[model samples]
Target: MFTIQQIDGAHAKVKTGADFPKYIQEIKELGVTAFDFLVSNGVEVYYGEEPFKTNSPAKYDPLNINENLNAQQFAKELKEHQDGKTDFPYFVKMCAINGIASWKVDLEEYTCTYFDLEGEEVLQEEIPGE
Candidate 1:
């Protein structure tokens, strides 16, 4: 089972069961490049930890950038994933670009926590059963 929680405008946390790795592999089979996955889905993707800079007398925008995609496409992707028609690597990448460290699994607890770019707990909650 799994649960996802939005931490903020561009960050979220996901808690998943022991089957996380398999889950990732399944999504990889979807054959979507990370870039295409994010843009097509309207989720923003970033490369590294540098904030964007604007030279308005030395004002720095957050180097890290976020995506602004079609909301309908995003919603459609979510629905497809829920129906088991798509994989989640795209979402996983989104989380990582936005600042999630790793999608590590805890064997004993059968769960994992996603951290935001600031290393803060964001998503945490398991499905009702399993």
Candidate 2:
């Protein structure tokens, strides 16, 4: 099961277990695009420091899975992307299809966080000078 919360006026957050694909399909059934739904639902951002560039091929790659692919197939594809076995272009397409704009994995906590398009965290190192 999955839970969705509104983060703010323009964002929403989602929490789920291993059944992320089911929740994604649910969101799609709500008449909202997966990207918009995930973004509005506040999916956690991953690799915030190195945001996907607007002109990157990955940003525009199309999802190529078979139309008849099942939830398991979706999950498998997403897992492969998460494992870094896929290229950025493929990852981008996967993200678009899955509505996972940003994500972060916490090894210590054994948790994953997903954020919306606007939820990406900007990393800033503190400087000595004020």
* Residue range 19-106, candidate 2, lDDT tens digits: 3343444433333222322222233322212232111113232333223323444467756754546754455456555444555433
Clashes of each: 9, 13
lDDT of 2 at 57: 18
Model 2 clashing-pair count: 13
Q: TM-score for every candidate vs. truth?
A: 0.33, 0.29
lDDT of each: 0.33, 0.36
Error of 2 at 47 (Å): 11
User: Per-residue CA lDDT of candidate 1, range 13-129, in tens?
Assistant: 223323334543332233211211122223333111234211112112233323332334434543454455544555544443444443322333434444443445545433222
Question: Least lDDT summed over 10 consecutive residues: which range in candidate 2?
Answer: 121-130
